[model samples]
Target chain A: MTVQEKSWKEIPPAGICWKPSTEYLTGDWKTYKPIMDSEKCTRCTLCVIFCPDGAIHWNPGKEDIEFDYDFCKGCGICANECPTKAIEMKLE
Target chain B: MFSEWKFTAKDIAEKADLFMSGHRACAGCAAATVMRLVLKAVRGPIIATSATGCMEVVSSIYPYTSWATPWIHTAFENVAANASGIEAALKILKKKGRIKQQRIDVIAFAGDGGTYDIGIQALSGAVERGHDFLYVLYDNEAYMNTGIQRSGGTPHGASTTTSPAGTVIPGKVQYKKPIADIMVAHDMPYVATASPHYWRDLITKARKGIEVDGPAFLHTFAPCPRGWRSDPSKSIEISRIAVETCIFPLWEAINGEYQLSAPSKVIALRPERKKPVREYLKMQGRFRHLFTPKFEKIIDEIQQLTDKRWQRLLKKCGIV
Candidate 1:
């Protein structure tokens, strides 16, 4: 969504931000994508803990980890730090 | 006495996200991870205040904020002061029956630049006054928000824009200031040094800090890929190696009594298990110049200093 142009007086006083940053999608910054191999996964959740973006999730229903590509910047940290090498970074 | 909160990975996963995704933090930014873990440990209403630093700038761009809780952005030197005021106001509101919540956690976050140098006065005053808040310093070891400039927390032999490595001089000439020890000297109820690599320990310490009645301080080692010239994906690895090398030991002080944390405790007990400082430096490009033959003495000096500091810490903890 385009940011609406506002006059200086229209802006919130003291620069208060009313919206949550989740509205901004950062996945566009990805040059690489983290692909997970369920077979090799240990479900250790290190990626979930270390993810700077908080984009990785532990899906209780599937009993496995999942990635939210909508916000993942493809840092390759999950792939790099995965002990079992379950996650791999592939070109976007 | 504080009962430990044993949080598993699943438990953390199930919790609500206080620090949301899609913020502008760099990929593999360990400071962001520090913020996430700290927020995860606390339950109930939270009022977070951040000094002017990378986390503040990246998380709260104009019009959007990563924080789900009430957050205030303060100047570089007064985050703790701001938290102090918030805590005071909250106390008054609760006493007057204006606020319904029985308790509110006030947390202040600052980078090494703000905590170690610029904001040290405010932090000291707030802690000395015994404010009911937790001051978390995500120390990246330099002024990373502006540029790679050396801060008081920057270790010896590390290169930055201000302390450039050259033939004439090595990197930073001085050693890292003992900010944790300084905080402990304030006689606060809780003070801890943590690293993001050890999330459980960090989370537990954060909880204790929040639960304590008086002021608490947490110095967290945050690796900056851009500033340190390290691979972004290797941030955790670097953090782990730093602990293993005894350069940044994980330890805490309760009521002025020091005790090494699990990871650092093991190394302290079995000194042989400790990795060489070279292993830690090799991962980051900031110390690339130190690998040269001419700077061999500088590397040895750093290793010597690290070992000395480790031994000193062991003594402080009464391990030796």
Candidate 2:
């Protein structure tokens, strides 16, 4: 349902759905991108657990967590919290 | 103990996007930052409800919302009541085989005006009934959306539009309502105070609150640059200073068992760790009127109050 609809019911205008806010690409707000190197990774998942935003996806298929740059705001919490310094911020 | 606190900006960025950017929150608003941090821990489908306030007004407007999960903007008061109804409906829908809504988190978000004042009755009723939901109070210390009117959560001696500092009076004459303590007094399963600067602690407490089988209340310290007349970029820094100064002590209660957070625990262990309150008070324009020598007494009074509260908290944590 469009939120543009004048009525207050759930329509596109309301933008209320079971899905999350995945459509908004917030990467432009960041001046840096966190680059994760799996070779030095510990996989404790602390970064994943502690990330204020759900930008890290635990890709068991890749045997490491992956970052969707589209969502990361480059707050650097993950890089700072990484026990082994596996995640590094690369300037855009 | 400060050395033990782990989560940093990077750890938090990994879990981004429950509340995305491109929305209308003023730059560097602590309330918006607090919302991002709190929304990080929902591991599954969640339904969030916000009471009318800055968060409700700024984040969700018609045809656009920052929320990625299902959200409902309820009226100013009775947010908890609406959440309770949602929780009940979830159970009934599941019972009737209408919807498999299992594991869906039901959360209510509100500002101090909605929580400590307008919504207090509904909050009390919802908690008393043992509704399974989490209530997050993003307290920015005043009615910031309506131009910085003093609120029940406003700290003592801080100036606001309503509590203007002048020759007749210093600022707000009364102390904060101890809203979190009142929530604890309700005999709930969990209650905690958090700040966005302590991202790890804040996130863990929120996750615990939402995951609990019954009611959980999280009183977050949200600093408002506009309301405080402070620097916008220092939003996180302001919360950091509040914790460091022991003015906004962080602690949690689980089934009546109280434990001070790491930083506060350090202060409890070593009273010497407490910083003077002037740095915090002087940084905000709301407290600017008290900077003069004539108002020095008010600063001392505030310092005394902070020490007393810290001592009281230490005693409860059994660290004294």
Candidate 3:
């Protein structure tokens, strides 16, 4: 009813998608963040490789991994996949 | 927890998401998980053709869509053909100079029911015609959206709604369709079987599948917790057990050369480290009936079949 009530000029062009994929972020849905124990981290970058959300990155200067909490869903997959158990997920 | 793997979680986290979240997939759904992994393989523009299944329903309801990239929801039986059409149109556009950018990777996603049954003919035609595209089948082993009806890809001894385990029948007694092997016989450049638990291997295969010149088929093990009667969170864990027990192996045939992926490769290397089949069988409720004394022979049959299947795979890969 709301859509039909709109004026002719108010309606968007047909066959057009207004919202794109970038608008959908999952930061609010996460419950944890993976914290890497740098001392045990082998720099294998498995954490960077398996993070589905691209929430982790390599600190080029420090040569350690860093987490971008904005995109991290805290799936704990990084902690699970970490070979040395160097990464542990902390509750958000 | 033990294997020689190169990439880390850090590496995967650095890549941007092409398959966005907020989709309506089941919690811990393996299909949705694999979708994310496969999307990571393609960094550039992609056009995906999704069949009418869980992904289509969950991702593309009335007002919203979960796909970050452009996607089309095709019919239940003609997804491959639809994808092939898109591939052809793209090539034509490139030839006519109407499109002046990099080649767009066209991918078709389907469930096991769409792939191993209704869509097989269209799939065969597309692959046989030498279309350059990747067809990924997220095989959850049944028609989950329609209340778990038995499909052609359903494994032997698994009970579904249509093939219920009753006094007269044990379950769906037919073997799984050899999709990966059959695709390889099509002589496509790449054919792989992957699992969501093995993201590194799956990602690599997805990239290879897209890069190949002709049709590439990827059969991914999508664990349906609801259908399988397992804890939703156990999707990845149960899949890991499936591979460790050599029941759902991770393998790929690149240019006709078969190779076992991680965990499977590790397990196959050690002769004395074979995991017990019961460990995997006990996790899923569909296989629960097999544990009873009356069904011990069925259990034995399953185990024997698993061993024989692994042996056959090893022989094909030249490990034997």
Candidate 4:
């Protein structure tokens, strides 16, 4: 997570990004967290499709949806768009 | 109709993540979803170029990039131009046996400000030259990246920083420019308007746009919670209500032949299915002033305009 300062001559031209953005944890921005109710879940995937952050994932081993809280900013879109009301947004 | 191209949740989950998370987009940014769906639809090697806008700014910070695929960041007015060059170079490289891939989709992502106004000339020139690429315009209705300034895609009554709703003026004075129809006039192989709410349709159109031989244009409606002054969670609902109210209809034109998409087709066939413009307007804070008694007439005007445009589109699609 530390940003290493490189010499000006060592930097690549055109401001190239050598690393992927996954290192940045965006979960701190959330004021609310979405908790999924597996009992009422239909696995219709509406929440997965509408999630702006791509934080919701279909776990094949467990055969259920999992939330990656590291990237989930807790927009509540999954909670709002869930047909079965399986996802509830709770204050973090 | 697009059942064959429909993507199940598993199918989408199985696809390689092209647009990664941990970028700087807002909590409920619809444009981010648009980018994700588009890359998912392409499902192949892609060389993406983006104009300077919200998505570009958010995805490509100095030290990191959200795009897993090869991406180039260009200036505000030359994303299409950049894509055109990339496609031409790839073609040459393939001819010289330098590249191994059979086909590499070139996609240019731009916001409404870049597509409708600043970069229109470059886009027009690139498409007119018959470049093999897909130009995806994610229209959030205004210049949202630069603090909600007005753009050509801003609707007639939506207020912005540049076009404030006041005693003299009622938000933006001009209607949204028909950028999709303008591209259709170029006689490209594919042209379509989509919203993130209709993810299936949007992905389908994106696939077709990429697979086409000549240039293609996809005008996507992306709801901005910050600029629109609405709930971040309601972005999908706002996009859905937009189509239901006929404010932003889903349709496609193939070689200048217009046809309504499924959602709009239902409304075109059964007029009663169409919701009032008020329902759509009431959701966004940008149009809050229009609900006041002084601006009540503007709402009626908007409704009349919506109905008129819907009828015209139906006639064009030969559904009337």
Highest DockQ against the true fold, candidate: 1
| Model 4 chain B lowest lDDT segment of ten | B1-10
Over the true interface, candidate 2 deviates by an RMSD, in Å, of 5.8
* Models sorted by DockQ, best on top: 1, 4, 3, 2
Q: List DockQ for all candidates.
A: 0.83, 0.13, 0.22, 0.79
For candidate 1, the chain B TM-score comes to 0.98
Please list all clashing residue pairs in model 4, or write none if there are none: none
Model 2 alpha-carbon miss at residue B296, Å:
1.8
Cα RMSD, model 2: 5.9
> How many Å off is the CA of B169 in candidate 4?
0.8
lDDT of 2 by residue, A1-92 (tens): 33343455544442553333455455567777888887898787766644444556666566567777776666665776677989888898
DockQ metric, candidate 3: 0.22
True contacts kept of 3: 0.18
Relative to the true structure, candidate 4 has a C-alpha RMSD (angstroms) of 1.7
lDDT of 1 by residue, B123-240 (tens): 9999988999999999999999899899999999999999999988789999999999999999999999999989899999999999998999999999999999999889988898
lDDT (Cα, tens digit) per residue for candidate 4, span B55-133: 9999988788999999999999999999999999999999999999999999999999999999999999999899999
Best-fitting candidate, measured by lDDT?
Answer: 1
Clashes of 1: 0
TM-score of chain B of each: 0.98, 0.95, 0.96, 0.98
lDDT of each: 0.91, 0.80, 0.80, 0.90
Per-residue lDDT tens digits for candidate 2, residues B22-103, read 4555544678767877887776788999999998887665445678677888988989999999999998888899986567
